[model samples]
Target: MSTHSISLLLVGIEGSEFRLAAEMARANGADVSTADTVDAALTHLRTHGADLVMIDICLDAISFLERMRSERLSAPVIACGIDAPARLAVAAIHAGARDYLPLPPEAELIAAAIQTFANRMAAPIEIEALVGHTVADVERELILQTLERCHGNRTSASTILGISVRTMRNKLRTFIEAGIPVSPAA
Candidate 1:
């Protein structure tokens, strides 16, 4: 069963592709709507609440998404397009999109992404939920990358990461709890 009521607003020009995508999403039990242009979409957003908004990451899309963020739309959006560029993907995520996908996405991929987004939206945020950084996720990645850069030298890793030897040991303890294996260098 789906985790949440899946309603979506698909923003793209009127075309066979958009219609097909809309049908595909609806077939997966999503309540789907369409907006042929940016202004129309923004107006729709003001009146209707949707779980997701899948948009074409075209020139108009870039502008539309920026405006959405500036206007503080809270619905999680997923940008979709044919051969979307890496920078566009980064920009979309930064603009508060939950994820981005290529056009005509596989059924399973679409379903999985929708499920993941729903789960994430429903999950509670907790101090303990911060499994990264203070939970040693960031520190561990840095340690691994730095160790790799230092040719597996603990002293050099410490210098690169700007942490003392004892601090590194303390971090290792947290890293162990985070389930990251210590590199042989440590």
Candidate 2:
């Protein structure tokens, strides 16, 4: 796919990683925008059309993905961070991200990830992607159990899960991952 065919939103609090991602995106020919906060990123999504988002979930921006899915943003998102937890990565994909990659990512990896997300976004959501007893299901169950222990208080749940609130938010995305269908009752 041509990079010009897609718009990329690069989000992270002010830092070198954000700059690196933006530069890589530009080199790949993707029209790119930078957002310092999840709120700003959401505004950009509302005002401008983006094909994908490269996010630093380390800054606790995972909830932004959940909110995006909850709001029904059609564009695919990709979470990028260094040493991001497996749960967070899974949650991001579940929340509707086409993929996730570790930060300090190679330029080619970023480009490829973007291309893959673009391709996937162009297709219809496939129910077969959600099969019996997926890893997402197990993680969601764990998260729900933790939430119940915390009495639905996300802060407490995050503490119990040993992750940041942003990571917790990303985990919530798994509940909405395409055809996964994690219900409130689950």
Candidate 3:
């Protein structure tokens, strides 16, 4: 089965707003869940590994962020509210929300919001993830990881790495000739 990126937790939004947000997120491939309070959201996060979080600004979102910090819940957060003032959006960001999503959801905006966070799912390259002891080894690993991130789509990985598709194909060929297993190109 194809994996969907949205394992979203919705907190404090109710009635039409909650339904709408969930529907929009689902329409854009999110597997959405809900929580009416901060404690409940925390409990859910602790139990279920996930995800991008969306909490209503009208609720005690700042408190949630503080508690999430104290509890070390590392999921990135997004704030949602109806007619929220500018200060509140700034405050949400200051409190560690990745972005704000205004309510009475719009599909395009939800897609954009999901895309913004989806891009962050690529983990940073770490020393431990690299194999072998040479600069060539690092370069090979980076290219392979980037290709994996792009789901074996050479064109996309090439664009991100600022290289051409021909070069990517050549590199993959070289790696394969060297007995390195590579993802099948899409």
Candidate 4:
């Protein structure tokens, strides 16, 4: 388990359900905050920085998610909706949601989601400490790992890393310029 506490933002969630979810998250070792609107969520995010965001499906979740991404809120988002249409769920994902859950979310699921996010958020820190590496070193290692996993195919690695092939090439160039050895493409 990570020593760092996981912070979570809940958008447009209220009532007894919100209370229960908040309690469950706290019990699972998370610090949680709430927002009633997109603007409020953004404000909370700017001030507190969340590892994960849970947006109520009723709050025009797709739009909120798009706005968050536009604002560079990199936290993984979870859309919580009640019997939402498949189209709506797909739209939410396209808008940058990492997961979608039914309304009145189950406590176990919420805890699991938070745990997953926490693990993701803790990874870089753990890597850095374990290897005594800088951010660039970690990034280079990750890119190389992805490239290897993709069989040295730049396009596939870039796609998996959510970067353009051009960007991947540029990063590789930087590594080469720094005299870092990289395996040739297969």
lDDT of 3 by residue, 3-106 (tens): 44768888874574755888878878888898888888999999994679889888878889889989888898889888888899888876777778887778
Identify the runs in model 2 with alpha carbons over 4 angstroms from their true place: 1-3, 117-186
lDDT of 4 by residue, 2-69 (tens): 56789888886567364567777788888888888888988888788888888877788888877776
Q: Top model by TM-score, which number?
A: 4
Off by more than 4 A, model 3? 1-3, 122-186
Model 3 lDDT vs. the true structure? 0.81
What TM-score would candidate 1 get against the native? 0.61
Q: Name the weakest run of 10 consecutive residues (lDDT summed) in model 2.
A: 177-186
Q: Residues 1-186, candidate 1: write the lDDT tens digits.
A: 465757788888887465577877777777889998889989999899677888888836667777887887767777887887889887776555656788766777677766776676677776564554463455567787787777767766775465776787777677768787777763
TM-score per candidate, in order? 0.61, 0.59, 0.63, 0.67
Tens digits of lDDT, candidate 2, 25-51: 777767889998888989999999687
Ranking by TM-score: 4, 3, 1, 2
